[model samples]
Target: MAVGARLTPDVLELDPAAATDRIVAELRTIVGKTLRRRGAVLGISGGIDSSVTCALCARAFGPERVLGVLAPETDSETETLRLSHVVVSTFGVPYVVENITPILAAARCYERRDETVRELVPAFTSGWKLKVVLPDVVGNDLYRVLFLVVESPDGRQERHRLTAEQSLAIVAATNFKQRTRKMIEYYHADRLNYAVAGTPNRLEYDQGFFVKNGDGAADVKPIAHLYKTQVYRLAEYLGVPEEIRVRPPTTDTYSLPQSQEEFFFSLPYQKLDLCLYAHNHGLRAEAVADAVELSVADVERVFRDIEQKRRTTRSLHMSSRLVEPVAEIDLSDA
Candidate 1:
């Protein structure tokens, strides 16, 4: 789609300094006017999106008023926690750490997902974590089959074709992580009278990268409109630790190594951002292909995948529908 001008390299450009100031003001207004909350609370996962969102929250609500909760599970990277602490301390945001492994354990998330994984790979054992990935399309035909990748602590790996039933059961079980984190965040929010801040940037939010009512549940999503690239720029402008600014984005959900690109999108985030922007602006596949340096066919494939996921996840993005109002009573003295 034409942006009504020649599409330059600056099409997706972000001015970090100015973006920071503008988002800070927007956050302040949301908390002060919309939510009427005294503060913001969030789960800081050490990713650029969360780091920038937390920094903005602290700037808007003061370090003392913002609570940064570190929710890590057994598979969580140690560096995730370390970087999380760096941001919390760097901003002096009041912090809490919750090890979420037990919660998942109690909810039978591990056993259930493992049970499903073992159906495909009987060698699945206690020392391993599993990640499920969908096969990519080539040429005019895309593969719709799913694959389960298992890795052991000593770094052994195996790939298995996963049945749809297994994938469904596995996802249903593992989604407890995000939902559990949301429950913890809200427990504090209830007591502190703060708004739970969601940290999804435009790409993740628009593409349904979040679990419904889990990581997707939040009182305020301050960065949902910014693209992944823009979030990094804000990280740099806000002095987010250089390590964090440079950290590769990961889903960080699986026990084994997995990146957001591998888990969901067909392309890396840098390229995907250009494709998403082009797609949103009504550009043809060829136009996006030129911008992100991909073949026209690849751009078309990404566009189709984007539409498929957006359609698939529409249910996750909706509110409950009711035929009649529950709270609005018709009879005054019934």
Candidate 2:
């Protein structure tokens, strides 16, 4: 409930020109002084965060020093792959195409996900893509239920409540995607002695919209402090392809295309970004509702939902806890 009350309206909408300069400079500093690495490596998902992250890396380290790895699996959207290449070509960054379908198949991620989906919707077939969503939990509600939303090739959609077990199975399965991608990113980074760059914008990072030790793992998160709207503005200024720029935010992790809203957030990114900022700034729900044109109840729901997400996903922000030190190592040893 207390994310702090900071009046940061100007931070919500960025001046791309100034941002580019500051980010690029900060990137150079982080890369040169902090990471002690020659270059940076990242997975290019063709999303706004990935696009802007790569662009900043290119500016800081040059296209040659930035390696964009395109790791796509069977469930990934075609446009995501297509636009990934666009980003690499636009930035003239060196890249490698690594199809991860075989790896995912080996891991049985899709099979596990399918079995769980069929448990809920017996008619679920190969043509169906499933997305799990959680309803708003607010105001000391101890229990929060999860839901499963699926789409078929014929454009039919279904939504139903999911048992905790069903949700866990699906998540445990699909999470392999993020972990696998991170593995590939690290492989390349290790070979090149480069730091693994993270692509989470402020909204995703604050809301815990990443997987633990998966997409959540990064050597450096250059855009972790910028909101979603700011990331888009930076994308446009960085010359991200117009098609990619205008593409609606999506998970792109499922067989059927799904927007980020249907999968997670209740409101659109722009509105959500403002609401989140306002909430963080200690604005009352009624004031935020008037600003974003929603009812006070709805705004309060969003605020509480934000709190719920931050609470549940808190562990993803942490390192693995150890009960005790293996050997009381000294800090000066390193």
Candidate 3:
């Protein structure tokens, strides 16, 4: 079998028209017919995944039936709400803006996160910004270590290796933001009698990049099966605003501007996409390295990291466990 030489950039390309039609049809069936919901509700994050998911939703259920929700917190990028508006308008879907700053504040989300940061850097204060990142997987480092990056009020910056306890504290505090936003999403969904739509792409989904009971909880997920790159292709075909279509992927969950690659994926979406596709299709490391323009060693490292994340984050994909299985009625069949 040919190794990586046979793989090309177009390896994941699909007929956008067909993909859109299929997704829209399935969304209708799942959200409407099966879920017993009249419409769909999803948070628009000003990211490609959410934008494309919103547009597909508009096509599946009439624009009027789909509700686009914008839930931005204190640390959210300034451009997030603006770009989210662009998405809702371009798709002609109605949306509600729920500024979650007050909610986060009430829950002490910022306070707790800052307290943890201060434990590491005593000078951390109001004007300081921070983000947590992992070591570059594509580099010589084989071990994955999380580092804290903080920008001082006066523009100085520092990186510090976090203890496991410190990392857990900071992450646990930051999780309030996602859980809060998810609460709002569900509130709207319940009031509207619509299903909550999740926007995670295949890579994020497969790697467990979502918060449990937060972004991870959704009534229907339309784009979970598509690669990040494929989501971009669908964005273009669906007429997602050029601004959102071109914006780089971001966590937007951090106070400091953080790209999704630096924060989680470790590799840019394009390369990660190729590596993931190769691994899934049984492509060898040498072939993947050549296809993605990375060294063979880097490809192997990425493949290992992929498996590692799968093992570590497997619970994110699972439902609540019980001592014994409970059989439920199939409403669709009923």
Superposed Cα deviation of residue 16, candidate 1 (Å): 2.8
Question: How much is the lDDT of residue 292 in candidate 1?
Answer: 76
lDDT of 1: 0.84
Tell me the number of clashing residue pairs for each predicted model.
Answer: 2, 0, 1
Residue 152 lDDT, candidate 2, scale 0-100:
77
Candidate 1 minimal-lDDT segment of 10 residues: 1-10
- In order, the Cα lDDT scores of the candidates are 0.84, 0.84, 0.90
Can you tell me which runs of candidate 3 are displaced by over 4 Å?
1-5, 328-334
Residue lDDT tens for model 3, 1-334: 4543656668889999999999999998988788889998999998999999999999999999999889988788889988998889899999999999998899898899889899889998888999999988876565777899999988899999999988888889998988888899999999999999999999999999999999898998999999998999999999997888889999898889999888889988999999999889888888777778899889999999999999989998997677865578333473
Candidates 1 and 3, the one with greater lDDT: 3
Off by over 4 Å in 1: 1-6, 137-140, 152-154, 326-334
In terms of TM-score, the best-performing candidate is: 3
lDDT of 1 by residue, 1-334 (tens): 3344434456778887788788888888777787788999999998898888889998888999999989999988888999999999888898999998998998999899888887877778887777878665435464576688988778878888777788788889989999999999999998999999999999889999999989999978888988787787778888899988888888788877778877777577888888888889888876666667878887888888889889989988897876987787543342
In TM-score terms, candidate 2 sits at 0.89
lDDT of 3: 0.90
